[model samples]
Target chain A: MAEKRLMYGNHALVEGIIYAGCRFFAGYPITPQNEVPEYMSIRMNEVGGVFLQTESEIAAINMLFGAGAAGVRATTSSSSPGISLMQEGISYIAGADIPVLVINIVRGGPGLGNIAPAQSDYYQATKGGGHGDYFTITLAPNSAQELFEFPKLAFELAEKYRNPALILADGLLGQMMEPVEFTFEPIDPGKLPEKDYALTGCRGRPRRVVRSYDLRPGKLEELNWKRYKKYQEIIKNEQRYETFNDKDAGLIIIAYGTCARVASAAMKMARDKNLKVGLLRPITLWPFPKDKVAQLSERIKDFLVVEMNCGQMIDDVRMATQFRSRIHFLGRPGGGVPTPPEVLKKIEEIMGGGR
Target chain B: MTKEVIVAGFGGQGIVSSGIILAYAGMFEDRHVTFFPSYGAEMRGGTANCSVVISSSPVASPIVAEPDVLIIMNEPSLLRFEPRLKPNGLLLYNKTLIKSEPKRSDITIIPVPANAIAEELGQGRIANMVMLGVLAKKTGILQLATLKKAQRIRYKKASEEQLSLNDQALERGYSFL
Candidate 1:
């Protein structure tokens, strides 16, 4: 087994980036997620990587675009409002077929809402926030361990499909500390596969172009169709989720990120009192894990959807179950987080006063 | 055994650091632990608090709604966290700073003169360490040796003399009657 160390979620993200061979980072500082860039400023130097404290999120994301286009494992991070600034840059990156990593350690939002944890950016992240039709492969991790582990996975999936990847975390997950064991040894950047499409100056070969626009008729439409095929491949192969106590559950709780941890605790509390409560945690926000939710809804008639926002993920649950599973919602928008007891009470209410 | 704890104080009181040290000590012993803190404007204007969950089994929620252990380092922290303690839980307050007594009769409350003890050993900032020592002795969840080792690692940049002062403070608080 690997050695374990207590690490904060934000700092652990830097460690994960270093371990995954990401050598370029450009980010603007924001609260709750401030520790990411703060730690990156130090660790990037130690790892001999490029770390830029850009003047704005726009500058940081554009910097990421340039580095990623050059075939460097480039990344950037921001909170809700800062992330909104990166939208145009992200759309360009996605359209250009460049692999990049962007982290939104979300705080309460819509606009400078507060520096507290929230998941209100679900629609923005999943349904394509910037412009046109595009989706960043979204991953939501619930713990510091996953925060440390998901960077490598995100980078890998991004490179595999040559698409933008978003780590959709919140202030609570970013601010917490837990013991994390490094899952794999650090990868040497030199050992990673060379990119065939990178713009490497083309000294001896013919000139190449890496771009998102095409003035020629039907050229842009062809690119969109090709990207659509890749997305379908991802949806078919990459829907990830985790379930607890779902086999014989009378009521299943659907949540992700911070809310999932609270739901897990609530499930344990409900189980102690002989109430059959279960949990289904979605690891991917864009792929959405609709198949699993649909399968469970076929048998389980009761569900409680929890989120730290005004019922964002509940819509996905309702669509997955086709509005047949009697879904109950417990949403606390802005900065409010659901407690285990509060979730358990909702579970009791949904489970017909606890059988 | 699952021990949900809330340690609270002013911003400069090392409230967050003590919570991490407790969780770290538990992790060092191969137990599951989590430390979640309050950040942003709350820490700037009001009391700063952190929740720690240490359990033999895997910890689920990092947030503690009703804490079994509440360590209050300042008067404001006591006022903020006292109402949320579980019945029969343990309450350790810093007597040198907080003059008010707890109102709850169901929980066990102990007032430690953490600042006085740390001032005797030297700086007032190590009061959180003293409180941890009393917590270790009274609750038995954390071992003295583990706390010392965790303290060494957490403050690995400290000089040998400074480190020894911290150990002595923990010892003084541990031996407090």
Candidate 2:
């Protein structure tokens, strides 16, 4: 039987990572996302998994990098500032083409910002917070239920691409509780893709070298091209998003994570008053569903890009529409999340006079 | 149909736990539920609250601007949430803490002495359970048995004495209405 229970988003995410065959976890405590590691501290022991309270976010990501390169399904979670500290390790992990899962339970930021929900990390997560010409397959889950599914999906995608997959969640989703049932079967770690490049004891076989450094002049450029080709494949085959009430929508709201959930409520409110508004929520922030938005932009005239940041995803939306569709941005920079009524007001403002 | 509820009170009043219990009851009855609690500085002994939305259909948003059921456990919460209650909504408050009555005549207000009832049961900390009892009976949002079942599940890990005291508080509060 399918397991059903009420779970906080952070707890569900920890359970999801465990169910997805993660045998190693290392992270530091941070607000909003502290529950993720807290739950792992207890539950990981119960599952016979290794859990580490690392010294810092840098140490945690490097631990994950080591575990991931050793062909073990490993994970690490942190909030925005902590994730910022993991960028160098993430860049190395990507450069080495290792499969690992990184979770960012995003809070307000620019500098030691408050621990409230924010989607300001869109650029940081999708546009490569790490210094590299590579991308991580990023999944944004709006609810605790989706929190259970995305970790498994993230692991699978990471293994398939031989690169890191990130789960980008906000403080609201991480802290909120909702009913969740594990929709997928627990993945067997033994059945997962075997990394031929893993540094296992050789047993007379050829030893594998897994490092980010490539000193040879042309060799480094060739390695970057290989990474770009893999990114293109992820972009082509892994783009994911969801559309609601868009068939006849005169206005479309582009949002993700917490903003998408609020926009869904606003969509219902607008429809009740007979306003033709719709919502397009990107489930995968990187490898974003630009084609779907482009297809809709041909039919829809007005687009409202709502976020919890000072307008980051708006750039991607404009790029998707080729700057042809009428676009308006609604966002709060730091801790404030726009409520459903506020989003409904934005919808009306856009429909009233293109304002 | 969707029922949006806001439970508010000072810190340590079990404001967020009350919302969680209500949501658990809704889930027990096979309804979709969302529970969003206040975070950050508001959690440090100041006013705290949580929003719960129970719906027959999928809950769109957890943010409840105009709640159909507004539960205020203290005077500050009443002042903060009273104006936001929808017209013809159900307003449940603790008469023990809130001395004044609600200003709105458009809604149904039920003032239960939650603290007094819990004190009678020898556990004043379970006042939120008392309010939950009144909410279940008055609004018909969840059946009495369902609420009790939810309480049992919530306190499954709690001590035996604590469970019985909560049971007494809930039944006493239910009978008060």
Which one wins on lDDT?
1
Compose the digit string of candidate 1's lDDT tens values, residues A95-154: 899999999999897788999999999999998789977889999999988999999999
C-alpha lDDT (0 to 100) for residue A87 of candidate 2: 97
List the candidate 2 regions with Cα displacement exceeding 4 Å: A353-355, B42-45
Per residue, candidate 2 scores C-alpha lDDT tens digits across A267-341 of 998998889998999999999999999999898888999899999998889999987799998998798889899
**lDDT tens per residue, model 1, B1-177:** 999999999888888889988988999989999999887776454678999999999999998999999999999888888999999999999999998889999999999999999999879999999999999999999998899888898889999999999899889889995
Q: What is the interface RMSD of each candidate, in Å?
A: 0.5, 0.8
Give the lowest summed-lDDT range of ten residues in model 1 chain A: A346-355
**Candidate number 2, chain A TM-score:** 0.98
Clashes of each: 0, 0
